[model samples]
Target chain A: MKLTKSFNRSLWVFHLNTGSCNGCEIEIVATICPRYDPERFGIKLVGSPKHADVLLVTGPVTKKMAAKVRRVYEQVPDPKLVMCIGTCGQSGGVFYDSYNLDGPIDQVLPVDVYVPGCPPRPEAIVYGVVKALEKLERLEAAQ
Target chain B: MLTDIILTLAGAFLVVIFSLIVAFFLLGVDRIVTARMQARIGPPLTQPFTDMRKLFTKENVVPANAIPWLFNLAPVVALASAITILLYIPIGGFPPVLSGGGDLILVMYLLTLPALALVAGGFSSGSPYATVGAQREMVTMIAYEFPLAVVIIAIAWKLAVSGVPLPFMLMSIQANPVWGLVGPLGIIGILILFFVLLIVTPAELSRIPFDTPEAETELAGGVLVEYSGKNLALFTLTQGVKTVVMASLMVALFIPYRLSALVPAPAILQPVLDLLFYLILVVLVAFVAVSLIRVSMARFRINQVVSVYWIYLSLIGIAGLLLVMADHFIGVV
Candidate 1:
């Protein structure tokens, strides 16, 4: 619906894992499958942050990955959005208050959307993406 | 002389525009067919256009260690050289823009320019992944070069032996469809050569099965890891154009038949019929060589790619050449 912004339709996502179990990653893969087919909306999982319009971050930040996450965030050029997936990246999930914990991802990056669960369902992640799109539209309107 | 120069310049401009459209069509068909084969409704046909527009507007990032000038220049050279090949190779119903100016050998050499530019860009990017990718790409180029040369040389040899003038010329090749010249034995030979070229097509375009150099999963975009924004957009455009170049080459070589020739039409509409038929051929080639192969096969290991081309495909291509040679001698006897 945001016709003016070309990136609105073609959103190339880069997936980053600070250090959670692979639950959110599996769900993300499911969302990209034939049934969900995010590619129908031109959403693709890109290999490099340089190629990404959206950064999908899963897992809580471990001590070492904190800097790596920030570096990748910097690598994704301007007009970028970050979505923190799963409760691990939101409130640290089961790893809450751990010694090696560097985050809740919001501490490390500006998260535009948060889909929280032990590992959020694929549908919930897709809804979170819709929310991200809405946020993008609002920002465009403000501009 | 001045008018001639003006005519050529104008013609060249038209060819550029025409090839770009065909290139976009090839990309759209590839993506949509790939999606459908996987049982999903794909993105719109104009997805490439939208993606290109978005890439142009995105920020161009020159990595800290990259040689900025070469990094920027590579994509321009790649895209320009890709368009350059179209100038020599006849497309649709029309003669090549610079028809008779260059020949098959020149086009063959020109085909390497874009890939060379890619290697230059990859090496210039100063990333370890890109360095490895550049090397892999160079190796892939070397591996496939022999089989491709075998296919072209065998065709031109047949034409030359059969008393055709300027057998290497694109016009000559297009004017005389190869299928007509050969006996049944030679027909089998030509089909094998055609098969060789078809397998090589994916490798030439760096699609799946031969996409080790740009292995997105392991190498993280590999040779293109450091490329972004307008530079990346230009590279993507180069890819689309190269797809058309390969498809056009295959169509011009194997299936040069014009629908207009079979179904008589108005003089004005003949070119339209020819162009439409050419497009269908191009799409079919792209589907078989790019989309279908890409969907069915996973990426080959770089070593496996080398063996497939060097050991297996080269042998197959040589056997094809031998059959063509044998058929020619037997006909004379």
Candidate 2:
């Protein structure tokens, strides 16, 4: 993982939904609205995982989505950060202990930053990104 | 002869570096201007630089299904061909470094090389999305070529009938300002042709409103879905260079007048004034063609793109061509 200041400033994120309700996804969209304007920090929502430096994975991984999630995680180029958004991805939230369960995301792929809420507010998502940035900066310093 | 060769080599090196810098600067300006228009504070002007640097540090992924050599070759070819086009077109107040080596016809063909390289890359990536994108890109290239050819041929044709030597050469075109060659009716014709060319610029560069090949919402980055890291960065740079190419061509053909020619300036400062004027002209053309059109309109469907250029714009171009022809006949009689 080659961490640099440039990487921290311009993190192109690819959002993946692993079968959560659409709540987290809507919040993710809101994070990019003109009011929030994540682009000011050079953070953009790219369409492809290949172009992404940060993977914003929403939802707890359903059995069907676990493999796809893993593939997407792999697709992102190295030195990547994964943020598990919403409580569902952290511990299955409302879906906890379900019969078809395959995730709390971490079980399926490495999780770097977790934003926990039934559906985290857009502010929480932004703060989670700041935390991710701090982690990236720390990694840069350690190098 | 040796000195000529050395000077040409030096000029090529300087122009490449200068074009790269100017391309990035124009892209940054486009983003900021677009952001302001949308009522949002945009990223800083240095954002594209940071994005390019970050991409270089990331892993360069070669998809398992891809033809690695062709996939890797695409970006280099795209960027190189784009810069090659710049070498033949006038820049600022100076004539092209390789002005006599190639002319308008060669430039029209060179203009297609980057897009062809893109299509080649997209097909080689082995992604279903990339395949679809490549098809759409090819369609776009064909759709725009008619009006583009019409505009170029009309100008050259007009110059030829007027008995200007080497009408196909950019130097002759610049020297004989197409605007001055025609009368009232021809001015209207030239304006129409200019308008058609302006509409074609965005499609040529594949920016918004005509960016069907990379439609993020529908195809998920389309032709670029499988590209990552350094290859992606180079493609981004190629896009910037292509924007400069299209804008410079617009400047060369329609708005070739120089600030130095308009106002008497000291010999040394003349090029400086002309370069600044040229930059302003490029920015204005880009804003109208790329940024304004991008913001005001939504993407056109692939079929709509074909009809819009082939049927509508071609008609407008022909109308302009006819007017120019009429102006010539009327003048000769």
Question: lDDT scores for all predictions?
Answer: 0.92, 0.94
Question: What tens digits encode model 1's per-residue C-alpha lDDT throughout A1-143?
Answer: 12346788888999999997999999999999999999887899999999988999999999999999999999997778999999999888899999999999999999999998878899999999999889888888887
Tell me the TM-score of each prediction against the true structure: 0.98, 0.99
lDDT of 1 at B233: 89
**DockQ for every prediction shown:** 0.58, 0.90
Q: How many pairs of residues in model 1 come into backbone collision?
A: 0
Residue-wise C-alpha lDDT for candidate 1, range B55-160, written one tens digit per residue: 8888899999999999999999999999999999887888988885899899999999999999999999999999999999999999999999999999999999
Q: What is the Å distance of residue B52 in model 2 from its true position?
A: 0.6
Residue B124 miss distance in model 2 (angstroms): 0.8
Q: What CAPRI-style quality would you assign to candidate 2? A: high
